[model samples]
Target: MNLFTDIRALVIDSLTALQSEGALPEGLDFANVTVEPPRDAAHGDMATNAAMVLAKPAKMKPRDIAEALAAKLLQDLRIEVAEVAGPGFLNMRLAPDLWRGVVGAALEKGRDFGRSSMGQGRKVNVEFVSANPTGPLHVGHTRGAVFGDALAALLDFAGHDVTREYYINDGGAQVDVLARSVFERYREACGLTPDIAEGLYPGNYLVPVGQALKDKVGDSLLDKGEQFWLEEVREFATEKMMDMIRADLASLGVEMDVFFSEKSLYGSGRIEAALEELDAKGLIYEGVLPPPKGKPDEDWEPREQTLFKSTDHGDDVDRPVKKSDGGWTYFAPDIAYHYDKVQRGFDELIDVFGADHGGYVKRMKAAVSALSDGKVPLDIKLCQLVRLFRDGQPFKMSKRAGNFVTLREVVDLVGPDVTRFVMLTRKNDAPLDFDFAKVLEQSKDNPVFYVQYASARIHSVLRKARDAGIAVDDATLKAADLSLLAHEAEMAVVKKLAEWPRLVEIAARTNEPHRVAFYLYELAGEFHALWNRGNDLPELRFLQEGDSSATQAKIALIRSVSIVISAGLGILGVTPAEEMR
Candidate 1:
């Protein structure tokens, strides 16, 4: 049902025929041939570079190859006109019936119209929003959460066995700070003057964690030092923070398939096992790293340490796995985590990180490359910062989150649907401005509203048709006289629908789910364009008075639009509007 793919196949078959007839040379490579929409619609419906790409290899002029290819293509019933343009580009207009067939296909497939099998059932692990469990998730993590969740959904639609994962940063120094922060609150709950240290977390959200701890164990932990209560309180407080994070994610409609604890890598021989694999391959060594580039001599130190030969795998320099104190460095556990993922037999791995982690990407990729022996590919996507604005002014911080706005606060302001859709309105690597006033405005400038309004209008049309006793169910729409949809405006929508399956594969291949949101907005624009035209041209209306055949044909076209929008929004984890209020 991919019209472009089918047409490209036809072009390839015709080229083979030309070779068979001796009109072209044998053994020409057609891999470079491509069929896509013409850059300028005035040129033709679709354009191909088949002749241009094969001219040099075939030892023939491009125009000659194009002329021969055009004649071969016109023989097919699906091709209406195949014309050669500048140099050797072949522009084609498909038969109108072919466009009509796309509408029928959409009606038949419903939400599954654009689903692709391009991933071929590969096992993919997408790890995102691995924020520290010291506090609630902030606006920065919100973007990563939305991006990662949408990417996982997109991969699933593209036929990948995707596992949504969250790597808990519990085995770090940050968790210890969280435990001490809660201990201050615990003392406060016990009617004691607490010392709120400058280094500890200062969020009011920890007030409840402190009260909860006091309720659980009474005052037994009040007078104890870090030695007696640090471990017990660290474990307890980490769980509470994680619980709050889970609830926050649920409020935004994000759910992870796995919540991996980084602490498990310690005391379980996992870190040593991962390093042992590297050691067996001669990737581990005892060496001193050169003074880092761009560093002042006063700030640089030279010391022999246990290092991983990350340069052999593509890192800028060798990385230290153990510190001078003989304890594992921060990079050690990360290597172990990815090694465990590779050992789990995943075919591919993807990590979604913040923009500040740009420097960390090369080292992480090097670790996975060394651990998996280049068998598994790792793709890291970094999401840039989100600047919040309210009424053209900077928004204030959330007191509950200490100094930043929590994800829950954003969700509360505009609900989950708007929040999710607006977060993806920009590319992951680009900075995004989330304006409260503008996003909630009911206008075309708002992509979420524009897309949702299109869905709502389609539903309104269906209801009106049903009330008028015209059968508008998908089964009936599939049986309509689609040939009546011969108008150019109607065909424009069909052409866009034909690109769905292709667009899905492209977005999934590039690991960019924002493209889906962009496509939905374009589809809605095309739909709304046609809807507005109906007011001026009576024949273009979806509900034709006293003409059941024409009304059914028009309704079938719009019903197809709704099907695609629902599927696209579903991939974005946003609920489509049945009716926009």
Candidate 2:
């Protein structure tokens, strides 16, 4: 169903036939041959570099080989015309029947239209939204959550066994901070003026957690010292926060297959086990690290610390696995967690970290590399900041989240569908501007609206055809005489449709779901352009008043486009609009 792959195979078969007929040398490497859409659609449907790539290897002139290859390719029924273009580059124009076949394929596939088997069922772990278990997820976690979830879905659609996971940061001092904050609210619940000190969480969301603590423990923990209550309160408060976090994620349509806790890595021998595996290979050592370059920490000094030889892989220097106080550094638990992932046999790993964690990327990759011993690969994607805008100015800060905006606020304003689509409107590494006014704008400039409008238009045609007593189901539309869809403008829409499977493979291989969003936008643009062209060319219109047969042909073409759009939107966690409101 992939036109480019299909055509490339045809080119390969022809090259082999040329070799068999003694038109070329016995042995020639054809690895470099590729069939792809030409830079400009004006060039042709697809262009191949087979003749050019083999010219030097086969001792033939570029044009001489192209002419022969063109002649051989033209003999095939799929290719209507094969012409040798600049420097032995063979450009091809497949018959309109081939475009018709693409539509038929998409209609048959439905939601699985662009699904690919490129991963070959390899297991991949996509860990994202591992927000510290200190509070409800904010705007930053929302982006990471959506990006990771969409990415995992994209990989699954591309044939990877993807597991969505969240790593909780409960082992760190942050959880202790959460306990103290909740304790203040607990005292307030007990009718005392709680100490609202600096460094304590000021959000009112934890007020319920404090009130719940009094109900559970009664007067047992009342007026107790930090040493007496910190442990029990930390455990109780973390569970409450996690419940709140889960509810927040569920509201946004995110579900994690695994919720790994950082606390579990401590005192579980897992950290020691992971480092032991590395140390067994001579990758761990106790060493006094050199001070960092240029403006080192004012408190920095040389200290012999247990370090991992991260430099052996790709890091700039060896990294500390343990602090000077003999407790493991934050990176130690992280390495252990990933080592556990590798031990569990994930063929590949991807971590979705926020942009501020950009500095940790290299060390993490180095650990996965060392742990897997080059068998498995790791990819870290950093989601940059999303600045919210409304009323032509910066979005106001959330009162609940204090200075930081909560994820719920953005979802409440623009809605989950609009928020998800707008978040994916840019590359993950690039900063995004979420303008409330622009996203809600029902115009072409708004990508979510543009894509949804295309689907809505398709639904409108379906409803009209149904009301007119014409069968418009996929089975019927797929069976239509698609030969009537041979018009160039109509075929152009098919060309974009043909690119879906290829786009899926590319986006999944790159671990980028935004590419799906971008491709859907382009497909919508093509459909819209063809719709506009129908105004001038009556034959190209979906509804031919006099002939139901010809009308079904064009409807079949656009309906297939709608199917692919729905599939792509599904991967992006977006709902296709049946009717624009």
Candidate 3:
């Protein structure tokens, strides 16, 4: 029961009635008409731009259209007041019973109160945290993991068949580097003086990988050169690193539906098949790209190579698929991967990347566009860097992760709930400061705490009501005399509850889950405001003394708040606090 959408339909019906009655023109498009909350609460509960948008198309004055529309709307029993504001804007106040119905709907629906069917069951593939399997996931990957997981959850709530995937970057030079680094540790484990090369990984985290390799193959690989052992050790070390990465993600409550390997694309004829599809469309060519803008002549080397005509699909320049050495560039496997996704019949694709990969976005989109032949849409979200601070000072790096803070370190400090909620406190494109001291602080400034506290408070009320021998179960509270909830303070919270379904559609449409976090905070604020108001007025309190009926009515209102909070936190992969310690 989306109140805004329900009311908008009423507005549209009224507009059609106006046209039928000859009070308005015969034909007018209502697509641009919108029903949303007024900028100022003083105006009304909701505002519509129907008259403003249709006036020009219908060849009528703005005020005349608004006045006529307002009269038509006021005839409906759900609309308590319909006032025409300046320039054909119609502001409306819905009947109190309509707001009361939102509370009942929430109790009836429980966590499903705000779920939407906006996506209409479209298949969506969200690929995120595709970090290299060379080490544990760092803080940047943590943000992407949280963002992508939450986005997948949000899309699922919006009725999309979402597949959470991780693309393993094992078929690259980095995995070879990881093997050499582990070989040094293997040498160390074998009681030899190991040469820790400068370019090889220098983290102590590889000590276990080395010890494991020694345990598996023993001294047989001790005296062998790269040619004798690199392949065997590379596959072994890559699996160990992937094991560590999986544990890191599991610590944060992120689970992928698929773990795709880049190595599979290399030997399976998939890359050639993807390129062949593009070649059939005349998108593949042998050409030389111009020198990059900032390159000096001495450093610029132009060579004819196998390239993809990415410019034809929106990229700024054509991209090379194969270098002059006949080796596939990094972009080649990526194209194959997305092409594989398209072949799987997904209707849409979303990739969550780090801020440093901003330059790679256009080329990737172009590749997917060319591969899918403009059928599937790809949305790439870039998560900026996360700067860690402890006690207002820069936090130290994790020795286990070489030089960066591991996602496990942050989760260990504050647990998964706080970690997940705090990561999404900002948008994906904005830089976030994760302050250990501040996020753990039990105050309003902490959004995770604030939202959780609201849930805890609601539970506390239910427990108190239960102990007092009042029935506060969902079925009972839902059947309460909700008409008793006529107080302005109670209505304010209900109005916020009514906005949840609308907010979910907005967030899903923009592919921004941060909006859900923001809406949860605002809903908590409204709930807390009503909770504070009860201090000055006894009638506003949840447990009204000697009146079980009144208490049930008020408890119903707060129970509705808990329902929405749980749903919102679920989308964020956060566990709502039953009671905040």
lDDT of each residue in 42-120, candidate 3, tens digit only: 9999999998888888999989999998988889999999998888789999999999999999999999998999999
Ranking by lDDT: 1, 3, 2
Query: TM-score of each candidate?
Result: 0.98, 0.97, 0.99
Question: Where is model 2 more than 4 Å wrong at Cα?
Answer: none
Q: Candidate 2: give the clashing pairs.
A: none
- Model 1 CA deviation exceeding 4 Å by range: none
Clashes of each: 0, 0, 0
Residue-level lDDT tens digits of model 1 in 1-581: 78899999999999999999999999999999999999999998889999999999999999999999999999999999999998999999999999889899999989999898899999999999999999999999999999999999999999999999999999999999999999999999998987888999999999999999999999999777789999999999999999999999999999999999999999999999999999999999999999867846896778999999999999999999998889999999999999999999999999999999999999999999989889999999999999999999999999888999999999999999999999999999999999999999999999999999999999999999989999999999999999999878888898888888999988999999999999999999999999999989999999999999999999999999999999999999999898988
Best by lDDT: 1
Query: Distance (Å) between predicted and true CA of 189, model 3?
Result: 0.8
Better of 1 and 2 by lDDT: 1
lDDT of 3: 0.94
Per-residue lDDT of 444-488 in model 2, one digit per residue for the tens? Answer: 999999999999999999899889888889889888998888777
Clashes of 1: 0
**Model 1 worst lDDT window (10 residues):** 292-301
Candidate 1 similarity to native, TM-score? 0.98
